[model samples]
Target: MSPSHRYEIEGCEVIWAIKDDSIGNTFFDRGAAEFFLPHLTAGKCEENKPLKRLKYTVTESSSDSPKKGDTAMGGALGPDWKDGWRMKGKHDQAAHRVQVEYQCEVQEVLTREEFTRTGQTAECFPGTSRAEEQNDDWPVYVLLTNKRLYGCDFVVSATGVVPSTGPFLHNDQFSVAPDGGLRVDDHMHTSVPDVYAAGDVCTASWEPAPQWFQMRLWSQARQMGSYAAKCMVADRDGEDIDMDFCFELFAHVTKFFNYKIVLLGRYNAQGLGKDYELLLRCTKGLEYVKVVLQAGRMQGAVLIGDTDLEETFENLIVNGMDLSPYGEDLLDPNIDIEDYFD
Candidate 1:
């Protein structure tokens, strides 16, 4: 979670002030320090490679929804997840459903005067105008679902981001992806020669490995930035550049919910639709391992805890060897899978 996307009301005490707050994965949970700066940013950040520094334009969005000045923000920047979890689709979705949801930024903050009074408020709060009741200087929040307004003390928004493709759009100089990022080839070159882009501002236009896809995450940003620099040097020196192995497969390592987690390939079965098979082994709070297989070939695996399967599973995915004969025994806890394969 970038501090850039986190916004808070002055002296806000809503989530903790109440009980049963089931907002979208409440990343900076009730009573937790707003960052709660997201552990994702701590260890997984890109190294300070020897490259020229690029500047970014930081802007805050202040749009408003009419029903309530309140809205939960999410977009290009993506969602703020728990203390960890580097990249992912949305949360609390049904197994049959895969969703990527982006909530609009809080359109506007409501002042006591700008707030609307509705009978629902009277029935809900019983005779007290919520707007009139909140601190005069603080912004008011409303939970709006389907145009119906519910009174709320405050809301925590995990803002999304769209690539800022500045003046390049003026003359149509660079190809832009639907997500509003500059499209770059394997070398991270824009359609316009000699121009390169990296980080959240550019999109990978090449055909990615089947087990790999892109998400706007710090880890990816680091990889792309470093790779782009190398490509620049290679081009300047008239040398050939090969696509970095980092782009060959999707992988992330982090600790979330107190478990050491290692993600490999299409760990969530993303883009596989319903054509994949899933096998999961979990031991309450201690461990969770999920593997995605297609036609008996390993495509991805999510290994939580120190399950010691990362190396073997990674080899399994990259080598693309057949594991059909092992059947369920592939994950049999009683059997030593590594030795079986060795």
Candidate 2:
């Protein structure tokens, strides 16, 4: 019988199954790896390579199942684990929590079918609290789950600014198009004019010959969101807004667990950057990284394994910086290479 889900002990930021690649390692000691992400990312960033696609080869390892009587700590990984992360000197506990949860959920799903299908049963008693008969000295403990006491004078719905439905939690977004070229929007806005949306929820239209421009992405989102917010505020205040700025959305790139992943602009934008050549290089591991360029300008990057270069890569992409400065240094692993700025 096949189980609905399976669990494992591993830590990974990006799990690309199509490429048979799983960037980042999960199901490992959290404490040990907490110190590895930065150094690893930095090492890869120093390489400055890029990839349009890639694959991963996963190796499975066994983990002991919890004992019959072991108590579930809900979400906390116990005091020792929590303290270990805190002692590491990183302020971000949410990252550690997310990685741990992913592993635990994977494991729990694997074991669920067995426990539920074996005709097992859970028993609980119905309790009656008699108001008058209760002892007067006992203290009552009340746990609030759905209390809505936190009131906000102004409500900002950051749910999303794009037309697409939701977050890119498990997989990327997919949608079909009219021409039927298999439009892979990735996350571009669906419309324009009176409204503009960016980030992972829009499909932008930009044409070199047509001489028009529109794009979607995190950086674009920040700019567009600011513009939109200002527009709204301006309209409310009866002020004329510029609204002349154009959005040049680029792909989002980052490193995690050691995997380098880049999501270039709408995948369906065919012939968009087709003529622009990009260079890529990598060594095999649990994580991989890639860098992209166009006409000598560093356009974007996808990094895993090492991400220390994220800031530099992002700067170059945003500023459309000339990549010729560090072309030679990118491939050299031992060149004390921060001089690209000079």
Candidate 3:
């Protein structure tokens, strides 16, 4: 069930089948504010403001960092980003508490029944485990895993979307990707000419642009849907249509750990390996900025906080302009980087 419907659904009892009762680590994409914020709020209005002001601590240092330093401690602030710093600080404090309380582990999920009847039952009183509470008369079913057994009545599958193509793939009419998504061409058309697939249900079949690849994100889904419509119309009219420009570069704006995060192109140096160089500027608790450069040209960037550098970086990446002359001065705090671009 989505976090939005957690409180709205009535009559049917909602049970969370989770490994632990800790509030953090409920979301898979730590950078997704939509997912992360809801879990933190948990259908509470009062928690919303505080959640926005929470400062996210950078626990692990990035491989590209010069020295192991806390990215959330002190950092240069962009204009109107004092709030960003405050929020990150608060989030860091809260995150520290959660870290101390909950040590997360990755484990395979099992059905509630499969877990309960595993022949390893440990009887314990209520409130001992963070799992659901049953009637005093009814014994709580404790499901055991390699890490720990969680006590709960019903298990909620909040894990994520799993591609299930077994039923459709059984038919000989379609070709499916190894990942189980329907293989689709640049036009978003599937193997069957008349049939087309888009969004999470389809795998990109065309040679992707250097800066763009498929991700199962809402933004990509929207782009695919719109582009697929145009492709379908062009096919109906027997007109050729070029692929949409949105696929030329990857762009995503989100909030992670209470800071505005903008990921552009190969933000993590995706397929570039060690062939690229990274220039980073971090203000502890203020902001973190990372730019990926390849062959002296800007290829990608990760902008945290309200850095107001997205347009400049995006242009630099799309245009493939050489910034080697500027060197590290491209990220120099004293320079008006945007003005330089102008």
Best by TM-score: 1
Q: What TM value does model 1 have?
A: 0.64
lDDT of 3 at 163: 55
> What TM-score do all the candidates reach, one by one?
0.64, 0.36, 0.63
Alpha-carbon runs more than 4 Å astray in model 1: 1-109, 116-139, 146-154
Please report how far candidate 1 places residue 136 from its true position, in Å: 12
- Looking at model 2, residue 103 earns an lDDT score of 22
lDDT of the structure predicted as candidate 1: 0.61
- Model 2 deviation from the true structure expressed as Cα RMSD, one decimal place: 19.4
Better of 1 and 2 by lDDT: 1
Model 2 spans > 4 angstroms off: 1-227, 240-274, 324-327
Q: Per the 3 Å backbone cut-off, how many clashing residue pairs does candidate 1 have? A: 12
RMSD of 3: 15.3
Put down candidate 3 lDDT per residue, 1-342, tens digits, no spaces: 343333222223333333444332332223332234333323222223443322434455545755655453542221224333332221222221111113333344445456556765544332334264333222344333434554434444546544565666767788888888999999998887688888878899899988888877666777898899999999999999999999999987655444567889988788898899988887765667888899999988888778999999999999999899999999999999899887
Runs in model 3 deviating more than 4 A are: 1-97, 100-146, 149-160
lDDT (Cα, tens digit) per residue for candidate 2, span 188-264: 22332233344334443333222123433344555555565666566568787554334343444533333444443
